[model samples]
Target: MSLKYAVLAALLEGEASGYELSKVFDVSLANFWPATPQQLYRELERLAGDGLIEARTVPQERRPTKRMFSLTAAGREQLAAFAAEPTRRPTAVRDEFLIKMQAMDGVDPRAVRALVEERRAWALGKLARYERVRERLLDGRTEEEYLRDADRVGPYLTLLAGITFERDNARWCERVLTVLGERRAAAGPAGPAALG
Candidate 1:
C-alpha cells in the first residue's frame, strides 16, 4: 500500500497536525508500515494539493500557528474504494535470520546468535511498551469492551498487531537460543559458536 493510504488511515482517527501524525506513525504503524517524518510531511502536502485532506491553521499563543489536517469527504470515499479493492499479496523475504541460521553449519553460529540476542532484546522491550499503551487505552475495561466500544480503532488494532508480532519474535528468539545451546553442546569444546 502507498504512504497515501497510510496517511488516510491515520487521519481516520481524527484531525491532527503533521507532528502528531509523525508520532502515530512512529508508534502504531512502524511495525508493518514504516515512514519517516519527511515522507509523511511531503505526503500530507501532496494529499492537501489533491484535495484529499483539508488543512487549517490553528493559532497558538507562544509558538507558531500549526496546520492541522483532516480527511475530506473525497478522501474518505477514496479510502473506501481502496479498501474495497482486492488485497495484493506482498512479496518479500519471509525471514533473513532464519536463512542465516539454516546456513550456520558453514556460517558462524556465534555471529548469528549475537544477532538473534540483539533482536530478542529489542522485540521484548517494544512488546513491553505496547502492553503499557494497550493498558492505558483500555483504562481497566474488559477485553470485550476494548474490542467492541473503543473509539480509536486504528491504534487499537495496530497495537494488537504490534503486540502479536513482537510476541512471535520473542518466541523465535527463545527457540533459536535453545537450538544454539544444543548445537554448542553437540560441537563439544571446539565449535563455531565458541569461535566468535
Candidate 2:
C-alpha cells in the first residue's frame, strides 16, 4: 500500500502535527509501512494539495510554527474506497540476509553467525516492544474482552501481526545460530575447512 493510505489511516485517530505523525509512523505503522520523516513531509504536502488532508499552522512562541493535519471528507472517502478494494497477496520477501544464507558456502561461518545473532537480538527487542504495546492496548482486559470492547480493532490486530512476525523471526534466528554453532564446534581449530 502507498504511504498516502497509511497517513490517512493514522489521521483517523485524530489530528496531529507532522512530528507527531512521524512518531506515530515509527511506533505503530513501522511494522507494516515504514516511512522516513522527509517522505512523510512530502506526502503531507501532496495530500494537502490534493485536498485529501487539511492542515492548519499552529503558531509557536519560541519555535517554528507547526502544521497540524487532519483527514478531509474526501480523504475518508478515498480511504474507504481503498479499503474496499480486493487484497493482494504479499510478495516474497527480498532480503540481504536471505541472499547471504543462499551464498553461505562461500562466506565465513563466523560472519554468518554474527549477522544471525545480531538479527536475533533485534527481533527479540522488537518482540518485547510489541508485547508492551499489546499490554497497553489490552489495558486491564483479557484478549477476548479487548477485542469485543475496544473502540477500534485495527491497531490491535496489526500489533498481533507484528508480534507474530517478530516471534517467527526470533525463532528462525535461534535455529540458524544453533546450526552454525554446532558446525563450528564440529570443525574444531581448523575451522570450516576441516568440515569440508
Candidate 3:
C-alpha cells in the first residue's frame, strides 16, 4: 500500500498537523506501515498537491505557522476505492533477521541465538504497547461492547492484528531458542560446528 492511502486513512481520525500525523503513525500505524518523518512530510505535500487533502495554515503566537491537514472528499473516495480493491498479492516476509537465521549453520550459533533473543524481546515490547493501545481504545468497555458500539472499528481491528503478530513472533522466537539450545546440548563441547 502507498503512503498516500495511509496518510489519508490517518486523517479519518481528524484534522492534524504534519507533526501530529507523524506521531500517530509512530504509535498506531507503525506495525503495518512504517514511515520516517521525512517520508510522511513528503507524502503530505504530495497529497496536498494532488488535492486529496486540504491544508489550513494555523498561526502560532511564538512559532511559525503550521499547516493542519484534513481529508478532502476526493481523499475519502480514494481511500474507499483502495480498500475495495481485491488484494491480489500475497503477503511477503522480507526480514533481514530471517536471512541471518537461515545462515545460522554457517556462522556462530551463539551470535545467532543472541540476535533471536533480541528479536523476541522486541516482539514482547511491541506486544505490550499494542495491548496498552487496545485498552485505551476499549476505554473501559468490554471488547464486545467496543466492537459493537464504537463509531469506528478499523483502528481497533488493526491493533488486534498487530497484537497477534507480535505475540506469534515472540512464540516463534521462543521455539527457535529452545531448538537451538537442544541442538547445542546434543553437539557437545566444540559448539554447533562439532555437530558436523
After superposition on all C-alphas, the RMSD of every candidate to the true structure, in Å, is 2.7, 2.1, 1.9
Off by over 4 Å in 1: 59-64, 91-103, 151-154, 192-196
Show model 3 residue runs off by greater than 4 Å: 62-64, 194-196
Which of the two, 1 or 2, has more TM-score? Answer: 2
TM-score of each: 0.85, 0.90, 0.91
State each model's CA lDDT, in order: 0.85, 0.88, 0.89
lDDT of 3 by residue, 1-196 (tens): 4788989999999999999988888877988887888998899999999999999999999988899999999999999999899976676667899888887787777787899999999999989988998988898999999999999999999999889999999999999999989988898866666423
Better of 1 and 2 by lDDT: 2
Off by over 4 Å in 2: 194-196
Listed per model in order, the count of residue pairs whose N, CA or C atoms clash below 3 Å is: 0, 0, 0
Worst 10 residues of 2 by lDDT: 86-95
Instruction: Put the candidates in lDDT order, highest first.
Output: 3, 2, 1
Output the number of the TM-score-best candidate: 3
The residue pairs in collision within model 3 are: none
